[model samples]
Target: MDKVLLKYAEYNEPHESCTNTDIVDILNKKHSAMKPAASGSSEDTEMMGD
Candidate 1:
C-alpha cells in the first residue's frame, strides 16, 4: 500500500541544514510510533462466507 512504498520529506528553506538521512530517520521514527490498523475489516465479512 501507500504507507509501505510511499516516502518523502518536507522542510522549511531555513532548515536546509537537515540531511536526507536525518529526514528519513525522523520520518521512520514518527511512522513507527503509529499502530497499524486491522487490515480488510472495512468490508462485509458475511459476504465472504457465502
Candidate 2:
C-alpha cells in the first residue's frame, strides 16, 4: 500500500490523495468478497472436520 502510494506521489497523481476512509472502504469491499481461511476459527475448524 505504501509502495503504491509512493509511486503515485512520484508521478504527481491524485490517486495518492485518498484519505483513511477511502482506503478502509476499499479494503472492506475487497475483504467482503473473499472467503475466510479454513483454519480461521473454531467454528470453521469444526465444519472442516478438523
Candidate 3:
C-alpha cells in the first residue's frame, strides 16, 4: 500500500515519524481516502507503476 500512502501524502503530508498504521488512520478518518483510476488512463500506469 506504499503507492496509496505516497499518493495520499501528495495531498496531505503526514508527521515525519508516522508509521503505516498512523497513515492508514489518517486516511480512514478522511472517509474518501481513495478512488479507483479511470479506464484507459495513463496516470494509472504512471502513478501505480503498472
RMSD of each: 12.3, 7.2, 15.5
In model 3, pairs of residues that clash are: none
Put down candidate 3 lDDT per residue, 1-50, tens digits, no spaces: 99877775755555678889999998886655343334347676787885
**What's the best-to-worst order under lDDT?**
2, 3, 1
Best-fitting candidate, measured by TM-score? 2
lDDT of 1 at 15: 42
Better of 2 and 3 by TM-score: 2
The lDDT, on a scale of 0 to 1, for candidate 2 is: 0.71
Residue-level lDDT of model 1, residues 1-50, one tens digit each, is 66654444343434446889999999998777652432344345656877
The lDDT leader among the candidates is 2
> How does each model score on TM-score?
0.38, 0.40, 0.31
For model 3, the run of ten residues with the poorest summed lDDT: 31-40
Query: Looking at model 2, how many pairs of residues clash?
Result: 0
What would the per-residue lDDT of candidate 2 be over residues 1-50, giving only the tens digit for each residue? 99876775656544556899999999998787654642366677687894
Candidate structures ordered by TM-score, highest first: 2, 1, 3
